[model samples]
Each structure stands twice: as C-alpha cells, then as structure tokens.
Target: MTQTFDPPPPDVVLDPEREASLRTIGVISYALHAVVAIGALLPGVQASIVLLIVAVIVDLVKRDEAVGTWQATHFSWRLRSVLWCGILYVVTIPLWFLFVIPGWIAWCLISIWFLYRIVRGWLAMNDRRPMPR
Candidate 1:
C-alpha cells in the first residue's frame, strides 16, 4: 500500500488580536528574563530557575496559538536565549572554583548576552519586525 501526504495549509495572514497579545507576552517574557538575570545579584533570591520556569510555561502554553504567525519567531528566539543561558550556568556550576575570576567574568558575559537578546527581541517585536533566525 502506498501512503499519500498533503502539505499543511498556509498560515492565517491577519490576526490583529493575536499580534497584540503576542507582543504583550513577548514584552512580559523579556522582563521576566531580565528579572532572572538581575535577581541573581540579590542576597537571598534564587530567581533564575524560578523565573525561567515561569517564562517557559507562559511561552509554551501560548506557542500553539502563535505557531504560524510572526510571533512564533519571537517565541523561538526567547526559548533559545533562555536555553543557552541555562546551559552556560550549568557549566559555571562545576568549574566555578577552578576558573574563579574568569568564571565570574564568563558569568558576567553570559548575563550581558542574555540581556542583549531580551532587549533586542523586545524592540523588534515592538517595531513589528520579525526576529532573525
């Protein structure tokens, strides 16, 4: 027996409400990532994981609705940024002592990278531009 496959329908072209809601969520996720990056500096708050969890949940839950829209790019960008930063943190955990000041330097660089992605993506979304892959 032979099986046949059909292409998926093209995405819906216009969705003002979806676009607005997506921009709102993108901004929220951007702020959430910032909070996590900064919260690490505070004395008692271990917010990186907590805030990441929150952002991931929000993004994943709404992702289905944005899949075919321009907003989907923002979701992908946000997830990649978070995933990379998390991996960097994991690397810092074990070699933290060996690297010492260099580790501190690396963490600082990673934090800056995280902030850059958030701000850049947020700005692009505000301008109604699609994120670069």
Candidate 2:
C-alpha cells in the first residue's frame, strides 16, 4: 500500500500593525549599534566601552520577534568575527607601536572582515538556511 502525505496549513500572518511594531524594534536595535560604533571615535575609552556594552544589551533585548531570532543568531556570528578580529588586533599591537601605518591598515582590514562576516550572516539568516556544521 502507498501512503499519501498532506501539506500543512498556512500559518496566520501578523497584521500590518504588528509588522510595523516589529520593524520599529529592529530599527531601534540598529540605531543602538550605530551609536556604539560612533562612540569608538570619541575620547574616553572607558566611557565608549560602557556605551558599546549598553548598546549591545539593548539590541539583544529589543530583538523579541521572529526577526529577533535572526538578529540574535547574526549577533553570535558577529561576536565570533570580533573574536577573530581581536586576535589580529593583539598580534598587530606591537607592530603598531613600531609604525602606526601598517597597524592601522591591519585594523582596517580586520574591521572590513568583521563587517563582511556580519553581512553574510544576516543574508543567510534572511534566507533561512540551516546553520553550517
């Protein structure tokens, strides 16, 4: 005997009001990240670090919808990217002490790498692919 498979019913989609709320939350989260990035350029490293930390926490908390899950996973990928960037920063610090140009160049490269990773992760999340093993 052959078995037949039935398709699942469509899920109830959120209304426009709920969709707008979710988008607003996402915008706020992105704005917080922008503030954190800008803080790095200001004087007082300690204060800037604190602001960045707060921004990260706020971003995490604001992500409470379906988009939030994607944002959280993207954030994790970015965190890993930052860890790799940190290793590069450590190795280049001594070089920076000797000559600033090469160190700055390395920093820029690492930053670009981190941004690229984040963008790729975001795109993958939007595509809804299974995480790689």
Candidate 3:
C-alpha cells in the first residue's frame, strides 16, 4: 500500500508532552529493532515474528500521533521492514530442507538486509532526518 504521511509544518512547535512521546516512540522503535537483530544471532530468543507483532502494534497505535512528522515515516518504514523479513523467511521455508545451501545463503542475505534497514532507520532518526519516501 502507498501510505501517506502529513508531516507537521516546518514552523510547528511541539509541546513538552508531544516531544516526550516522540522520544518514547524512538526508544521503543530501537528496542524493537534491536530485539529482532539480536534474536537472529542468538537462538534462545528467536521470536522475531512475535516481537515484530508487538512492535507493529506500537507503531499502529502511535502512527496517528506522528501525522505530518518524521516519526510517521519511521512507523511506515518499520512496519514494512518487519513484513519483508517475514516474507523472506517464509519464502525460504520449502528450500530450507530441499535446498539447504541456497536456503542458508538466502537467510544470511535476508539478515543483512534486515540489519541494514534497522540501522539505516535508526541512524536517520538519530540525525532527526525524515525517512525516505
């Protein structure tokens, strides 16, 4: 879906509460991203899909609050990122046993792509820059 975000006006002034909420969202986003990244590397906490669902819930809930702001862009990007990871994983399911080598390669590539997405978005947020459309 082509999502639309209305960023607050350039001259818009945020109240303390709104600022705090934005910060909270950023931290939560990072935590969610970190969980998936770490989970992939560590077998014990391999609940990426579940964790992503929680994160998506947070994103959906706060998305409206970020209307017209960079945070909206983040929510949009992250939701898609998680889904892409899920897609990649699902696509490799059949190949996992029949084509073990290719499946492993695909998994590794997906992991790298996932990490890139998370890190790229995190860095952009740190710089207070808007996510790409």
The candidate maximizing TM-score is 3
Instruction: List candidate 1 stretches off by more than 4 Å.
Output: 1-11, 41-48
Compared with the true structure, what per-residue lDDT tens digits does model 3 show for residues 1-133? 6745456688767778996788688768768877777677554667556776788898888888877776778888888888888898998988788998898788878877887888888887887776776
Q: Report residue 106 deviation for candidate 1 (angstroms).
A: 1.0
Relative to the true structure, candidate 3 has a C-alpha RMSD (angstroms) of 3.5
What lDDT tens digits, residue by residue, belong to model 2 across residues 18-51? 6566446444544444444434334453224554
Off by over 4 Å in 2: 1-52, 55-75, 130-133
| Cα lDDT listed for each candidate | 0.78, 0.51, 0.78
* Better candidate by lDDT, 1 or 2: 1
- Model with the higher TM-score, candidate 2 or 3: 3
Instruction: Flag regions of model 3 displaced more than 4 Å.
Output: 1-7, 10-12, 43-48
lDDT of 2 at 80: 55
Q: Write candidate 1's Cα lDDT for 1-133 as tens digits.
A: 5533222247566468767887788888888987887766454765758778899889989878777666788888889988999899888875677868787777778887888888888887787766767
Error of 1 at 10 (Å): 7.0
Candidate 3 lDDT for residue 115: 79
Per-model TM against the reference: 0.81, 0.50, 0.82
Assess the local accuracy of residue 63 in candidate 1 as a C-alpha lDDT between 0 and 100: 76
Cα error, candidate 1, residue 33 (Å): 1.1
Clashing residue pairs for model 1: none
